[model samples]
Target: MKRLISTLMIFAFALALFGECALVFEKYTTDTRIKPITREMIAAQIRIEEKLSEQTTVNTGEPHKSTPSRQDNGAWMLTLVNDKNPLPDAYKPILKSLSNGLQFDRRAIEQLNSMLSDARAQGLSPVVCSA
Candidate 1:
């Protein structure tokens, strides 16, 4: 009986501590006029915060992407299976389109286009492909 009573006492203290923590958190987020609060309300808010944190971490891919599974630069990199006989110059417009919305020269595009054309003439997939 004494052991059971002691366990109950500890449980009650733990509940009190949890309630205090909720009150403290609410005090920080709300005005002092919060005269009353329910334990359920505090528990709900804690659950919401935990869910949001989990979602943010999962969506950002920080911990997972940091793993060196494949060779890559910091920025998302793509590999082309085929630049479709895109003359080396062919890629220039795309590259330029990328740079300042294509304000750059078109010769680069022509070179890429020619290179792609030559590669395709060899019966290879010189096409624009992405990883």
Candidate 2:
């Protein structure tokens, strides 16, 4: 009984501090919605971050690892994330960056999804990493 009371007190205290609103994310779909990035996705994203700057590739902090092959065709699909915004950000900056800095191939998006799934199976939830 004492342990139960203590646990209850801890829960109440946490609620008092963070409040119920902090749990708001639990109510929504993570994909195409409000949520944090996953670990596997984080891993994949880290790989992508490396590919962004050619000048810094030699100095990049991460190791060079094999990534999923990008789509050979010119077509690609992507979701540009804006941490500050709820809805998906527009295609201006993202498109321009891709056009100038990287290949707009379909493989990037597919690889991210694949990594995210692997992470989920490895006991990681699909919560956003930077969240």
Candidate 3:
């Protein structure tokens, strides 16, 4: 009987504590006041969306001609060359030697020469340490 009374007292205390917490939460909790959207605001949003759509359509009409992948005998600038995506065994880039005896891909030779020339003109001694 004593055990049953003590268990009931504990349960009642837990219930009272839960009720007190519920009251405190209700007192502190507040409903967020949402400002209703006006018709003018909706119209403005629609106009902005229309302008964005127009700009996107205008920009997308002209398709960009990008360099083809390795399959098309062309090299992609962002080609992934890792263990999983290794270059083909027969793949070789045409190399050109720079004035400093450094070799690089023939396609990049013009840009590399231009950069080196510019650096030299600026009195900056740029050396090609590595390809």
TM for every model, in the order presented, reads 0.24, 0.19, 0.40
Error of 2 at 23 (Å): 58
Please estimate how well model 1 matches the true structure, expressed as its whole-model Cα lDDT. Answer: 0.62
Each prediction's Cα lDDT score? 0.62, 0.57, 0.82
Candidate 3 clash pair list:
none
State the weakest 10-residue window (summed lDDT) of model 3: 64-73
- Per-residue CA lDDT of model 1 for 1-131, tens digit only, reads 99999999999999999999999988788976656779998999999999998887655555432222333464323423233422333433323542224333343566666776799899998545431
Q: What global local distance difference test value does model 3 have?
A: 0.82
Model 3: per-residue Cα lDDT over 1-131, one tens digit each: 99999999999999999999999887667535655699999999999999998888756567764443446446555577765567777989899988778789888889988998999999999889998
- Top candidate by lDDT: 3
Q: Indicate the residue-level lDDT of 106 in model 2.
A: 48
Write model 2 residue lDDT over 93-122, tens digit each, in one string.
Answer: 232113224433344645655776899999
Best by TM-score: 3
Provide the global lDDT of candidate 2 against the true structure. 0.57
